[model samples]
Target: MTPNPTNAPARLGVQLQPQHANYTQIRDAVLRMEDLGVDVVFNWDHFFPLSGDREGLHFEAWTMLGAWAEQTERVEFGTLVNCNSYRNADLQADMARTLDHISAKGGDTGRFIFGTGSGWFERDYDEYGYEFGTVGSRLDDLAEALPRVKARWAKLNPAPTRGIPIMIGGKGEQKTLRLVAEHADIWHSFVAPGDLQHKLDVLARWGEKVGRDVSGITISNELSRGSLDDGHADALYAAGVRLFTLGLSGPHYDDTPVRHWLAWRDRKNREAGVGAAA
Candidate 1:
């Protein structure tokens, strides 16, 4: 088994939930986040609002991503976890490639992270007429679709500007962790600080079984639900997490949380002898 190093520099990400906000508001928020120096900007992939009015104003994920590709110049962006049930696997790959190229300006590589997962929202499935398969079946489908997504990237005419980083979300020890070991460049989780160690241990075991090293995979945890000052961020950082994400909702997208986390990120990075934006 390869060494599982936990020395990566701290980075901050914000998930601008695409709900309760008009497109113009969303667009401005994206620009503001980039200007605020966030390392990554993410949006969730669901058709309807995950919170507030269930039928409130919301926008599509991939389309908004395309606009984000055009709007932001520096921050890497993508779905926090795109639902695999909505589109064909091959089509998803192709669309990702197109977005990759679209984001590339001047000579810079595309700042797109292909974050996805086996979807779980039953409402999305019911309203959209997709098969609301059992959890096991959905995992099976994601297991199969990932390879095709990667293969299609290789076959695309221009190809992606960079080896697009794959960020997989979830922490199921059995199937989700296994898939993360096999395919992910980053893994997003909501596990609390105390449970994070066990999750990482499970991920390591999966990596050993799959002949892959899990150390290089960035660990992403959500900050939207917790008190950042409770020493949770410090504990998570101590547990080898490098990428921290905070979810922001609208009609009023608050920047207080973002600024607080960004300040925390800078402090952590500086303590580790790394630049805040590095």
Candidate 2:
């Protein structure tokens, strides 16, 4: 019999955009998501909303994470991509370790994925008093921060329940992919079906340059609007993406589309017949 690939099944994640809603609403939404059998739940790291109103109600990422760490019983969760510019690397590492422990309730690899990226939103930087550095500078900062993050994890009082998986989100081939090859356990992007192979090729080259086997790194693709077309998912699946994320806004995130995505996840898992590690 053929061995089932370790990453055979595709998984679904919900990006609970923490905007335009109260904490209770967000909390209830997460419970509802868990009931739907979503594999993961995510919230972005930003001080303000990325869409709709600029002054919409939004909660902080890491703080809310602590609550999820305690509240969630089954679903894995984390920042869709935490802004590396906002916090110290060591502190970030410590916080992740603590959350990892909190999430380890009966006994499981603590369901916390540390998804992060270089800061991009100008408003988050400006209003939050963080420096709005150039793109190059931010990427450089992330490259430097990752090592410190790992180092801190090593020296923590109580280590993480399991080595928290580090996921880096971005598509820049030069610095970003190189960093992914060096440090990330997963690489996230919005590459279309047509461009997916090329990006994977670039990532493979980066792995060779860094002397790391990146075939193990998970590929996370966005649930884009245009990607909603028929056969769109098939093309992406054929391209080797296994972790899909759906972005939803608060005040009232539409649940109809979410149900569709969850059903797709179930069908994909049933067909694959193995847990999708990616």
Candidate 3:
């Protein structure tokens, strides 16, 4: 397995779930999160609320992303994991490239991150008229689609301002890890601290099979389910997670939990001899 870089500073992220709130509230939350000094901001790709009211106020991911590209001055942004089944691969690439250009302030490269998955939400598929195929079939489709997305990026007119970072979210060892080895710049997973090392071991074998060194791929973990008091954050960091993300629901978009994680991140970075923003 690729060793966790002991010197690397931990980065904080938050997924502003686009449910249970209005557009203005979500917009305000975005601004607040960036102000709170997060390294990245994310949103989920679902048509309905995963919690609370089944028909709560919700917004689409890509369109809001266009707004986010133009709204935030800093902090990378993307979906926590876009459902690959929602759109055509080439169109997705073009949309990502467009956002990349839109996010490019001054002359810097775009900060858009293309975080995607094979999709599993049955309601989304059923309601939206997409095929909720078998998990293996969906994974197979994603494996095919990702390459097309990359190839399209290469052929786009102006091209992306930067090589848009590809973040694949899943813990499936065989197919998902292989795809991560083949394409991902970041791998987002929910593997528990105790299981992290084993997952990393599986990832490494996939990397070897693909003939790609996976050491450069950033390890991302979800911290939304638990508090930092449990020491899970520290354990994930110790294992290899450099990007720690939490999910914030709407209405008020509370920053209390965010501040706690931010403080933890600052402390961790300082201990590593890095600046808070680093």
Return the TM-score for each candidate structure. 0.97, 0.94, 0.97
Question: In order, what lDDT does every prediction score?
Answer: 0.88, 0.86, 0.91
Clashes of each: 0, 0, 0
Off by over 4 Å in 1: 1-4, 224-226
What range of 10 consecutive residues in model 3 has the weakest lDDT sum? 1-10
Q: How far is candidate 1 from the true structure (C-alpha RMSD, Å)?
A: 1.4
The 10-residue segment with the lowest total lDDT in model 1? 1-10
Query: By TM-score, highest first, what's the ranking?
Result: 3, 1, 2
Q: Which digits, one per residue and each the tens of the lDDT, describe model 3 over residues 150-177? A: 9999999999998899999999988998
Candidate 1 has an lDDT of 0.88
Displacement of the residue 259 alpha carbon in candidate 2, Å = 1.3
